[model samples]
Target: MEPMDKDRRVPDRYEPGEGCLTTAVRLPVRIVVLVLVVPVRLVWDALAALGRAAHRTVLRPLGGGLAWLWRTLVVLPVAWTWRTLVVAPLGWLWRTLVVAPLGWLWRTLAVAPAVWLWRYVLTPVGRGIAWLVRGLGVALVWLGKALFVWPWVALWRYVLAPVGRGIGAVVAWLVRYLVVVPARWLYAHVLTPLGRGIAWLVRGLGTVLATLVRWIVVVPLVALWRHVLVPSGRVLAVVVTVVVREVGAAFGHCWRVAGIISRAVGRFLGTVLRWLFVEPVRWVYRTVLTPLGHGIRDGIWRPVRQALRTARETVRQTRRELRRALFGAPREPQPAAAVPPRREPGAPGTRTLGSSTTALTKD
Candidate 1:
């Protein structure tokens, strides 16, 4: 047997037959597995490569091309056919044949006639109806006015006036008999005496007050103002008047001197300007400008005025001719109907007629 140390030590080299029998056996299996797996993997990889090649070279391009073909040939044509044959024609036909004719017919046959009828016939008829209604309203207003006035007239003429006169006469008689007699008696006896007594008392009191005011207040005030204040006011007024007069004299002398200087300067300036500028300008205007203006007026403005007058006369004559031609000549005025003469109230003929009518009615 080997030593224990040998048993504990790990061996560096393994023997093929002693300890690697299972590895050798597994090696065959591994080789077999490698063989099978490599072939299968190779087949799978080849198949995948073939599929990718087919997709890239054939299928993808075929699908894209087919899609493009379908889009170009089928989709575009179908869309074009639908739009051109169906949509466009149907829309155009609907608009042109149906909608246009219907619109035209509605406008010409229905709408235009309706507008005409409303404008010409219905509008005039409506205006006439409104006018008639207004006239009826006016007539009704007049009837209402008559109805409103009739009762007042009847009441005044038949009932109220007569009753009011009778009442007034009764009231007058009562007032005269009862109130007036008593009032006159009171005035004559009591009121007159009382009024006289009151007047006498008032006059006496007024006289006493006037005398007292005159003696106590008014006379003293008058005396004080006359004796003291009036003299002082007169002295002050005299002083003020003297001062005002002196100042006014000085101002007037200064004003006169200033006026004389201003007038002299103004006269000198006026003489210089008139001789230098004003007289020349005035001469030019009178000689050259006035003659030119007169020549223009005679040559241009006078002719224009004459033409305008002739045109106005022609227009007036044309207007008169048109008026005479369109409307016939004016008719002569007819004499007015003769007015009936008014009969005097007590005329013999009027009395006879009235009496004969009365007799006829009575018979």
Candidate 2:
């Protein structure tokens, strides 16, 4: 080999072990640090990547399934339980409180219309009926007056006064038919007997009364002497006047017996009447009056209140109708008549006054 080529070649003494000291040191430190930490860092990064991917892969489907299952099982049951336990009862309570009152108010509102109809319509009809009745009464009175009194007045003026003179012209016929001779016969025959009968009845009654009084006075005194005084005197005068005293005692006993019998009969009749009628009346009073009085009062009061309401409505309707008739737009008032103009005295001799008003009419 040439000398230059041999110089380009590595020298035998410049060996690999104879490198730069800084390069040698730096290369060993870098290699050792890489050897110690590079593989462990690579393993840890790979494990973290795998863990993140596994977490995503597992949690995605698990979260979706769990959400669906919760909606189907847990959430639905809880919602149903709430509806059954809390919401449904609350809704029922609200309906009972709110809807029931609303229904009652609606019914009350409906009843108000019926009441109004009765007041405005039926009340007016009743008032009209009353007015018609009053008019009929007045008409009847006028008709009665016209038929009875007017006819009598007309007959008296047009027929009876003139016909009464004709009756006087038939004096002889009247006398023969129903005048002096009949009067005298009636007075003689009927009046005489009637008077005599009345006088005889009166005289007879007076005589009977006087005889009764005399007998009543005399009989008591005679009986007193015959019975009491004679019996006592005879009884005292003798030891025991048996016949006279027994007769007097028998008369007195008869009177006492009659009185006692009459009293007993009257008392017995009174007792029977009390048992038959009075006890039943008292029982009925207690049962009906005391216990059921309020019910009876309400029963009667309802109809009477309705009747009073109807009567008040009728009166109000009558007044309203009268007001309408007097002041309603359908009826117009009549115009006043024009007064005649005053003329001056002795002002003009032949001046003619025109009519005070022309003919006026409503369309």
Per-candidate TM-scores read 0.31, 0.21
* Per-candidate total of colliding backbone pairs: 0, 0
Candidate 2, residues 79-188, lDDT tens digits: the string is: 99999999999999999999999989987888788899999999999999999999999999999999899989998999999889888878867778787888899999
Least lDDT summed over 10 consecutive residues: which range in candidate 2? 1-10
lDDT of 1 by residue, 192-252 (tens): 9999999999999999999999999999999999998999999888666655644454344
Reference-based lDDT, each prediction: 0.75, 0.71
Can you tell me which runs of candidate 1 are displaced by over 4 Å? 1-131, 142-148, 239-363
| TM accuracy, model 1 | 0.31
